[model samples]
Target: MGGVSETHQMAPRPRRRRRPYRLAAALLVLLGLAGYYLVQNESTGGDGAPHCTVVAGGDAGGSYSMNLEQARYAATIAAVGTARKMPERAVTIAMATAMQESALRNLDHGDRDSLGLFQQRPSQGWGTPAQIMDPVYSAGIFYDRLKEDVPDYADLPLTVAAQKVQRSGFPDAYAKHEPDAALLAAAFTGRAPGALSCSGPLPQDTGDATRVKAELVKVFGSALAPKAGPPASRVAAQQAPADDSEVTLSVSGKDYQGPADQRRGWELANWTVAHAAELGVQRVSYGSKAWIAGKNKGRWIDKAPGKSGDGDPRNAGPDDVRIFVAPLNR
Candidate 1:
């Protein structure tokens, strides 16, 4: 009877399971807040924003601001156009098309299957998805098609020429972007020397001559080389001049010539300007104009005649594009 009097053990209480759910909800809220902060910072010129300036025709043409990504894409489009010998109008059309199609953002998806900067559709024979996704490749293809389909695309209205290539539902939309596109093209194509500049935190690994040369080759083709000095000899020297922070890119006459050579030189010069932040470029000088990254906040400054290179007297020729890479830690 005593043994049978043992009380039955009460069942253990169930543990509360709400803490994990609450923690997860809190985490989601934090993440959402972080995302909101990033968006706000981008829109409000925060440290994370890629501050960029595009001046249409040097100082007199005025300037506009675009995000770093847009500047890079615009530079690429201009490079492609220049390489193809396409006129400024061609670059304008291409840029405007990209602006309308993707707002200058290279997207992985688009209306139905469009892709890349121009949103060329794989289903429509633009190229494979992979090819279309490459900014350089897509740009080349766009220029090629424009040249083929509209031989006189340079003379046609921006919207009409772009529509010929794009065939978009809202063909008229491209016109609105023409003015901005022209500004971008002018800057990137080098018509406006020292007109394009970008400011931001430099990359951890910045100002490598090898890397700069490689990028030049990648964008402008392997045929790219210095126009005057021995390419390897000068680059291999790697000795900073009196400035203590300059790299001279003397383009070869064989590579650039004729009236177009001036534009080509500027194209390279402007490309350096666009990539200043990433490459630690402090100054880009071509012909009589120079863009100083720190001086006047990266505006193009006129160099007094015979002021370049300690009275070397030979005017800064059309083929010369001098890039002064910022010293490390500056």
Candidate 2:
């Protein structure tokens, strides 16, 4: 045994060759992490950057997605059309025009003195700078012009109708946005219920009933807004405690837009969700569906029907919409 040991130089225990395995394992782990993050960012905007999507409703349906700000302006444009009782066709025309002109950014600058969503120039008498900058005001006037100046606009080709109002040098450009605009119009107009949603870094401000009602009235008009209850009610607003966090919008659906229907309720609900990032709306419930802010993809989940017991907003009527905003104290 001593003689064998003397002769044996244990051939430098052939270096285990473990490093290659270790490197392979490390690469696999890194690849796994990268895949996970990409998936998260695409689905939920995991960085908390706000995002919104509207899916067209049908068997051959498609979708369009955008950041939070553009979605808000789109909602306002559609609301202006609805408040005017203009058909969905008119809304599509206006949306396409805005997309071509401003990409819906509500730009304060454009060609020459042009400004606002439609890039209406002050020199053109669209309005004063201040009024034209207002999204609701700008959109309202656009629809007014379309209705007054373009007879039978709804039946015209979208590009033709939009070109007539916008008078853009790139007249054909509006037609390209028609697919995206039509999808948006259908969703925002309430013809495609639960078709719109947002994912977010929720706003930090507290929800204000007054602020919400004022926004609604601005878009839907004071005379036609659904009757309010409790904190937001015209009568109770003066006396109700300042802490009320939710507003009950009684949707008789009788006064605004076309004939009373469930779509009107969805219209209000979708608009609320589209602006939830700015308005501090935490939840919006209409009929049997509810949307929660900052949730993954901000999907509309089904809830039970009732008169305000569960976390779900009261579904006492078919058309009522309840908006639960972030509480000031929270």
Provide the lDDT at 293 for model 1.
51
> TM-score: which candidate is best?
2
Give me the candidate number with maximum lDDT: 2
TM-score versus the correct structure, for each prediction: 0.71, 0.79
Residue-by-residue lDDT tens digits, candidate 2, 1-330? 555574566566566879999999999999998887666565453644468889877795799988889999999999999888899999999999999899989899989999999999999889999999999999999999999989888788999998888888888999899999999999999888889878865556777867888888788776445445432112113224457677766656334333455777787888888888788887787777878765546778776555443255245356467777754235
Give lDDT tens digits, candidate 1, residues 1-330.
555433775667999999999999999999999997776454323534556787665355567787767778889889988767778888889998998999988999999999999999999999999999999999999999999999988778889999999989998999989888888888788677556666553444336666676677677764564435544212221364543455555554554556556767777777877777667665667788776554444455677777863222234555677766645344
Backbone clash pairs for candidate 2 read none
Q: What is the lDDT of candidate 1?
A: 0.73
